[model samples]
Target: MGFLMDLIGTLLRVNNLTYRYSSQDRNLLEKVSFTIGLKEKIGIVGPNGSGKSTLIKILVGELTDFEGNIEKPKCDLKIGYLPQDVSRDSDRILLEEVKAALPEVYKVEKNLRVLEKRLENDVDTEVLRDYGELLSKYETIEGFQLEEKIKKALSKLGFTKDDMKRNYNKLSGGEKTRVELAKILLEEPDLLILDEPTNHLDINSLEWLEEYLRRYKGTILVTSHDRYFLNKVVTSILELRDGKSTIYSGNYSFYIYERNLKEKQAWEKYEEQNRKIKKMEREAKRRKIWAKRKEKEKIGAKDKGFITHRAAKLAKRAKAVETRIKQMIEEEKVNKPAVEKQIRVKLETARHSGKIVLDVCELSKSFGDRILFNSLNFTIIRGKTIGIIGPNGSGKTTLIRILLGEIPADSGFIRWRTNIKIGYHAQEQENLNMENTILTEVKRENSDETFVRIVLGCLKFSQKRVYEKIKNISIGERVKVSLAKVLASQPDVLILDEPTNHLDVHVREALENALADYSGTIIVASHDRYLIKKLADEILEINGKETKYFPGSYSELKSKVEL
Candidate 1:
C-alpha cells in the first residue's frame, strides 16, 4: 500500500548467460540475457523445475559453471539472497546468529580501538599497518552503527528487541524466514533476489512484507505464487521457460492480458494459414489435372516438349506456395506459450440429509493444561455457508475435526442429521493416500466410471492428468483432486479446513465461484480474508470459551467489530 521505488537504471546486466548443471544433459539456462535495472522490481515466474531457482543461484554467485559475463555496477556490489526453506538450529540465540553477518567488521573495530589506546606505548609497525587497513575497510562499509541497523531491520520484520535474546531453534518456520529476511535487509544489498518470499507468511505478515518491499530502494528479483503480492510489488514480469527469459512490461495482470492477446492472435493466424494452405493445395491439384489434360492434347498434336516445361514450372510454383504457408504456421507457433491448465470435477452427494446438517452441544477441548476451547455450542443448517475465523491458535480447525469424528473432544456431544453424507477436506493429510492416482482416489469413493470422468472434468483434470500419481501433483492439484473425491461421494455437508492453501489466485477464484453456486451446506475454517468475504453467509467468530454468530458477510462483522 505504498509507492514502489522507481527504476533508476540498470544495476546488474547478465549477458549471454549459459549454464548447465553437472547432471543435466542440456543447458539449464541457454544463453539467457536480461538486465535488472536499479530500484526496479522484477518477478521471475514459471512452473517448477523451469530453472527459476537455478537462475537465481547463478545471479548470486552461488553456482559458477556459467558461460557469460555478469556486469555488476561495482566490484563489491553488495548482494543479498533469500532462499526458500528457512531452517534454523534452535540452539543459537537470534541476536548471535544475525550479528555473525558482521563479525569481521566488529572484530576490526575492537582491534582499532585497542591499537589506538596502546599508541602512546609505541605500537609495532605490523600492528599499525593492520589497524590502518581495518579502519579504512570499516569506514568503507559504514560500520559505525551496524548493530543498530540490524536491530531496526529485525524490528520492522516483526521481531521485538526482546525476541533478539530468544533461541533461533525455538522459532517456527515462519519466524525463521522473517529473521533471515531481516538479516538480508540489514546487509543493504544493492540487488536482492527473493524466491517465494511470501510462502509461509500470514495475511498480516504478508501485507507488512509487501509494504516493506515497496519502500525498499534496491533492485529486486522475486518469484512468488501470490498474485496480489506480484501485482502489488512487481514493476515487470520475467517469464522463464524453455531455457530463456522473456520480459513483459507492467504488472502481472498486464502480462496476463498481453499473453492472452498473443495467444488469440496466434490462434487466428494458425487458422488463417490452415485455410489458405488447404485452398492453395486444392487449386494446385485442379490446375495440375487441367494441365495434364492439356498436355495430353498437346502430345497428340506433336507439342510434348513445350507441355513438359510448362508442367514443371507449374509444379515448382505450387511447391513454393505450400512452403510459404507452412512457414507462416511455424512462425505463429514459435511465440505461443502454454496457458494455465484447469482441472474440472463434480461432487455428487449420493445421499441427502435432513435440514440440520450438524448439531453440537457443549463442546470442550484442551491440550494438556491449556484449554483451546470450553463450552462451545453451534449448529450448521443445510444450504448455508458458515465461516470460522479467529487467531492462529484458535480452535477453528479443532471444532471441524470434532464434528467429522476424526478427533475426539474431551467433552462434547456432536450429532449428525440422519442420512447425512459429509465431504471433509482435513488440514492434515488423513483423507489422502499419496500413492494413489488422481483418478484412482476419486474412483475409490465413487465406483461409476462416467461419474468419475465427469467429476474429474469439473475439477479441470484432463484425461492425461487423471493418470498422474497423487504424490507427483502440486498442492493445488492435490487439493482439487481431494475436492473431486468429496464431490464423488455427494455429501450433504462439506467441512473444509484452510482449503485455500497451495491454491493460485485463479484457482481460488474458481473455487470461490463453485462454492458460491453450491446448494449444499458448507462450513470452513480459514484465515483468507478474500475467501471469507466472498463466500461466507455467516461468520462464527471463535474465541476461547465462546463462539459468536453474526448474520451477513465478513464486511458486516468487521463493521460491527470496529464500531
Candidate 2:
C-alpha cells in the first residue's frame, strides 16, 4: 500500500465539510469528512437523495456554501470530472473533439521529435538540452503516443475508430457518453470524479469502463447504479447516509457485509443489556421485600435503638440499590431497526378475456416521415410480463402509448380482448395535479374516499401526507402517489413506464415482487436491469425499426441478442 501512504501524505482531503441548498430544509452534506488517496479508486454509493451528487458537486466547486476545508497538494494536480449527461457540439466530429483534450501535449511532442531528428549527430550541448526539455514536457503530458491511447480508450468503451469521425450531435446519448468518457481518459488527470458514468452504457461498454478504471493510474470517485461496476472498480466505498459519509474498507460487496455485521452486533448487544437489566431489577425487588420484613419486625424493638438504626440503614441501602437497579433497567439502549418499508401492491387483477390481449398486425408509426416502427408485428398474451428495453428515443414509449390507446398507429390494426381494461402509470402522470392535494388527486382518480386512504396507506403515505399539496411533495412521494392511483384502478392489464425513476432500491424490489405475484398481463418500459431481471418474463428489444422478442429475463435477452 505504498500508493495509499503517498496519497495520504500529499493528496486531496475534505475536512469537516457541510453544504446546504438554499431551498432545502437541511444540509445536503453535513459534517462529512473523507480523504481520497492518490491512485485509489473510490465508489460513492447511496440511495436516492442521499447527497451523492451533492458531494460530487462540492468536490468540483459547483456548489459553494458553509463548509470546512478542502486540502490538496501544493503541486499542480489536475482533476477531470464527468457529469451524468454530456452536451457536445453536434456539428464537430467526435474524434476531433476528443483530440482537442491535449493540444499542448501534442504540440510539445511534435517539437520534441523535430528537435531529436535535427540534432541527431550535432553533438551540441545546448541542442541536446533543448531537446531534453521538450521531451520532458511531452512525457509530463503522456504525449508519447497520444493517438494510440485515445484509440485504445475509445475502443475499450465499445466505440470503433470509425465512430470517432462521426458528428457528436448525430450520435445517440450512449455514444456521446462514450465519447466524453474517452476525452476524460485522454486528459490524464491526477483525479477523476464521475457521476452516473454508466447511465448511457450497455453491458459491454460498462464492463469495458470497469476494466479501464481498474488499470487507470489516477484516483477515481464514481457514482453509479451499476452494482457490478462498483464491485469491480472500487477498492473502497463511501456511502452517504443521513447527510453523513460512511467509509468502507473494501468494495461495494464488502460494504454490505460489514454493514450487516454491525447491525447484528448492535441488536445482540441491545438484547443482552435488556435481559441483564430485567434480572437485576427482579433481584432488587426481592431484596427490598426482605428488608421490608426486617423493618416490620424491628417496629416493636423500642429498647434496641442500635437494631432499629441498623435496620433503618439497611432499608436505606436497599432503597438506593433498588433505585440504581431501576435506573439501569430504564437506561438499556435499543438500536434502531436496520430495515426499510416499501410500497407493495398485491394487484388483484382479473384475467384477460382472450389468449391474445393485444395483437399488432403490420404496425407502423412515423413522425414527420421518420418511421419509428416499420411493419412491426407482435402479440402480447395473458399472464405475461413483457419488458420493452432500448436506448432513448427507440420508440419504446411510443409503442406503449399506442398499445394503451393514447395514440394511434400510423397504419396497423391493434386487436384487444373483448373487455380489456387498461391501467397505466404514465412517466409524467405525477405532474398532472401539482396544485391539488394528495387526497384530492387520489379522489379525482377514484371517488371512493376510504379506498383512496387505504391505497395511500399501502404506499406508505401518512395522514399528514394526504393533506399536503402535490407541489410540496418530493419526487419519490409523488411517484408513489401515481403508483397508488394505478393500484386503485385495478385494471385487467398494467402498463408502467420507467416506474423506477424516483424509487429507492428497496421500493423497486417490492414492486418487482408484487409484479411477479400478479396474475394478469403486464407491459413495462424500463432501463433498470435489476428490476427487469426480476419482473420481466419476456423482453422485447426495439432497435432502429427492428423489433426482437426474447422469451426470458433481461439476462436471457442479453444471451439471445449477443448470439
The root-mean-square deviation over C-alpha atoms between each candidate and the true structure, in angstroms, is 6.9, 6.4
lDDT of 1 by residue, 444-548 (tens): 888987888776776567788899999998877888888777767777788888887766555566677667656788898876767887789889887555668
* Number of the predicted model whose lDDT against the real structure is largest: 2
Global local distance difference test of model 1: 0.76
Candidate 2 lDDT over 145-198, as tens digits, reads 777887888777767667878887898776787788888877767788899887
Counting only residues 3 or more apart in sequence or on different chains, how many pairs clash (N, Cα, C under 3 Å) in candidate 1? 19
lDDT of 2 at 426: 84
Clashes of each: 19, 1
Note the Cα lDDT for every prediction shown: 0.76, 0.77
